[model samples]
Target: AFILGFALKDILANFFSGLVLLIDTPFSFGDVVALSDGSRAVIKKIGLRVTTMYLIDSHSEIYIPNANFQGENIINLSRPTSHYYYTISIPIKGDVDPARAISLMEKVVLAHPDTMGELEGKLEAIDNYYGHSGSGVKQKLKREVGRMRLLAEQDVTRMLLKIEMSLKQLSEF
Candidate 1:
């Protein structure tokens, strides 16, 4: 009995940890999360004892035991919003006007329809982006991105609701 109990200890811990995760639902399927090790991955599946993840940096699948997963500090990047802001550093020469360079870079960045800017300005900049030739293509790309974001959000919400209902049913048992 002692050997059997010792053998089952880790398994039982993992099982309970997974159950708590299901109840809490910190992240849903397809949500990108940063682990304690500073690695980022997308949640693929949550099983009773293990969670499957796709590592974004390496493009590999990893199955993490639920107990260890629960112990790690994780940040959900896909929750609430998926807009990831990044910084880029540019070196300017002594002869270049810093103010003018900065202004031009800002305009270039804001010209992309996917960036955060006034809707009218972004739409207007599409003409500048493609020399006024691919305006229709730019508009279509923007619409597609918007639709994908909406669908991802809806999927997360739906999954959360289903998890909540399933937990409620389990509690009654």
Candidate 2:
């Protein structure tokens, strides 16, 4: 009984520590965090001495020691409800009006099938100082486009990729 109690105490301590780390730490389950080497991952589990995450590009799972996580910069995409903001740049030559290009890009982004009904969208152009020199116009956009009620991370990536391709095509035109 004494040995069992000792083991149980250690287990309970670890579990509570895991829970506390989950709350106090910057990253949480399902957050896409960028590691030191620019490797991105979506956290899957927060354990006492380790954290489990899936790499974004390769779909590979990784276990990171919690001790190493201290002071590490992590991007938490899950805490704010899985919404993401991205900028799309479109280069326009002297012939094309910058305002017109901005408007067109906004239309394309807002009209995209993946972006249309999924989330509220905001599209706008960033100011460029040069005003010429083959300068590109940047559209600052934000969306909560991924479906949260169903589908897993892979499905979300596929949807995002589709949206990205559509945006690229629009920019090319």
Candidate 3:
């Protein structure tokens, strides 16, 4: 009985610690997290001594040890507050006004309903002459991609709901 109690106590401790870590950590549910070995997963649940994550490309669940979580650098792609940045680059090869291009891209990003309130967008130009043969006109665009990613979330959920409904309808048919 005493051994069982000790095991239970340890489990409880780990469980609460996991909860605390989940709340305090940068990552949250549905956020893409990169592990140390370059493996990436979407957070499903933060469990005791284990975090349930789904591999982004494979759509498979991966139980990551909590101990490893502390040592590894976790890149959280989603957080309510601004934590990550996404960039879209457009290369122009001619007598193109880089500033104007940036402005246009910025406007397009801001105009999107998904990007309007949640994320802030910035545009900059990088003249890459040394690295490449041609003068690389790179427009640096930054925004919290996860803010707009919620739209994808909603769309996926809506799609699943639609599939379920269709299945039900077909069953009746």
Candidate 1's TM-score? 0.52
Q: Where does candidate 1 stray beyond 4 Å? A: 81-173
Ten contiguous residues with the weakest lDDT in model 1: 126-135
TM-score of each: 0.52, 0.37, 0.43
lDDT of 3 by residue, 6-87 (tens): 8787566666666556445556556777777687788887665678899977888988666555556776644434454577
lDDT string for model 2 (75-165, tens) is 6644444355677565679899878887666655544323323332312111221123333343122122222311343454465567667
Better model by TM-score, 1 or 3?
1
For 7-116, candidate 1 gives per-residue lDDT tens digits of 99999999998877766788756678999999999998877799999999999999999999756899987654436578887778999988998776766665654455
Report the lDDT of model 1 for residue 157.
56
What is the Å distance of residue 115 in model 2 from its true position?
15
lDDT of 1 at 57: 95
Give per-residue lDDT, candidate 1, residue 84. 58
Candidate closest to the true structure, highest lDDT: 1
Residue pairs with clashing backbones, model 3: none
C-alpha lDDT of all candidate models, in order: 0.73, 0.56, 0.57
